[model samples]
Target: MPRFAANLSMLYNEHGFLDRFAAAARDGFKAVEFLFPYAFAPAELAARLQDNGLRQVLFNAPPGDWDGGERGIACIPGREAEFRDGFLRALEYAQALDCPRIHVMAGLAPVGRRREELKATYMENLGWAARQAAKAGRSVLLEPINTRDMPGFFLNFQEEAHRIVEDIGAKNLLVQMDLYHCQIMEGDLAARIRKYLPTGRVGHFQIAGVPGRFEPDVGEVNYAYLFGVIDEAAAQCGWDGWIGCEYKPRRGAVPYGTGEGLGWLRSPVLPGV
Candidate 1:
C-alpha cells in the first residue's frame, strides 16, 4: 500500500498551525507535509512531530516574497544568491527535522524575458541545489504545476520535469508527481505513472479532486484505480514514497471536516490499508 501524508497546510486549517500536527496524528496519518515551515522554529516543529509520532515527509524551499506573489526566485535571473541562501536555510530545517526531500517551486515565467533565459537559470540553480542536497543525503524535487492554478508557471509537464532531471544528471534530483496537476495538464495518468515510477526519478506524489481542489473521492478522476496503478507500478520498481493528501476539504474549515473527508482512506479502494 502507498503511504499517505497529511498536507497540514491545507488539511487542518481549522486548527492552529502547530496544533494541526496532533489533529493529523489523531486521524491515523503517519506522516505530514506542508507548503513552508519557515514561520515556526525548527525545534518547535520537530517537537510536534515527535510528540505526534508523525514524520515530516516534505516541504518547500523558500518561495521568494510569497506575499508579493513571487512563487520562486530560482528561475529568475540575478536572484541566484537569494535562492541559494533560501535553499540553505531550508536544508538546515530539513536536517533539524530529519526530512528527506525538499520541493523547489519553479517561478512563474515572466512575459518579457526569454524562456531560454529563465530555463537556463532554473537548470543552473537546480544543478547547484542538487549538489548541495546530495552532500546532506537529501533529495531535491521539481514539480510541474498546472497553469490554471499557477498561470505561467515555468514547469508544467511530466516529460519536461523528467527531462530536466536527466539533463541535470543529479542522482538526488527527482520529480514530485502531483496527480492533480498531472491530470489537469495531461490526461493519461496511469500511463504517466507507469512510465515514470519505474525510472526511480519520482520522489513523491500528491492528490486532490480535479475540477475542484477537494477530497480525492469528490473528483471525476478515479483515484481508486490510480491508487491501484501506483501500487502495482511502485512494487515493480521498488519505489516506496509517500503520496501527500494535498487537497481542500469539502466540508470547509469546520472541526473534524478534514478527518471526515478521510473516508476514502478507509475504503477498499486502497488495498492493505
Candidate 2:
C-alpha cells in the first residue's frame, strides 16, 4: 500500500492551526500537508514538526489575497511578478520545513481576459516556477480542481494539467492528482491512476470521500480497492510519494473509537506495513 499523509488543513480543523500538528501526530499520522503556510513563521512550523516527529510533506504556494477572493495568481494575465514573489516565499517555507513538494494553484482567470492569453501566461509562470524549484532540488506540482467546487479555476481537468506539464517540458513539474476532485469531475478513478501512474507523471495523490467530501469509508469510491490499485500502479512504475487524506470528518459519518473520523485508516480497510 502507498504511504498516507493527513491534510491538516481539512482534517484537523477542530483544533487551532498550530495545534493540529500535535493532533495529527496523536492520531498516528507520520506526515502531513496543508493548503498554505504563509500565516505562521516557517521556523515555528518546523519546530512543531520536529516536536511531534511529523514530516511536512507538502504545502501550496501562497494564494493571492485569499480574503479578497483570490485562489491563486499564477493564471492571471498580469500577475507574473506577483506569482514569482509568491513562489519564492513558499520556497523559503518549504526549505525550512524540509518539504520537497509545492503545489502551485492556478488562480481564477481574469474576468475578460482572452482564454488563449491567460493560458499562455499560465504556461510561462509554471515553466519559470519549475526551473526555480528544480534548482532547489524540489518538485513543482499542478492539480486539476473540479469546476463545480472552484468555478473559474484555470486548471480544472486532468488532461489539461498533463498537457501543461508537457508543454512546459519541465522535468521537475508533475501533477498533484486529488482523488476527491477527480471523482467530482470524472468517474474512472482507477483507470486514470493506472494511465497516469505508469508514465511517472503523477507527483502526489490525495483522497476524500466522494458525494460530500466526507469519510472515504462510506463514499461512492471504494477506497480499499482503489488503494490497492494505486499501490499496484505505483509499484509498477516506481513512484514514491504520499497519498494525502484530505477530507472533512463530520460528527456522525462513521463509527469512531477515538472521536475522530478516521475510518479510512482503520485495519482491514487501511494498508498494512
- Cα lDDT listed for each candidate: 0.94, 0.86
Model 2 misplacement above 4 A: 252-259, 270-273
- Give the Cα-based TM-score of candidate 1 against the true structure: 0.98
Per-residue lDDT tens digits for candidate 1, residues 158-255, read: 99999999999999999999999999999899899999999999999999999798999987888988899999998899998999999999875765
Residue 95 displacement in candidate 1 (angstroms):
0.3
Of the candidates shown, which would achieve the greatest lDDT relative to the real structure?
A: 1
State residue 14's C-alpha deviation in candidate 2, in Å.
1.7
**Can you list the residue pairs that collide in candidate 2?**
none
Cα misplacement distance, residue 252 of candidate 1 (Å): 3.2
TM-scores of the candidates are 0.98, 0.94
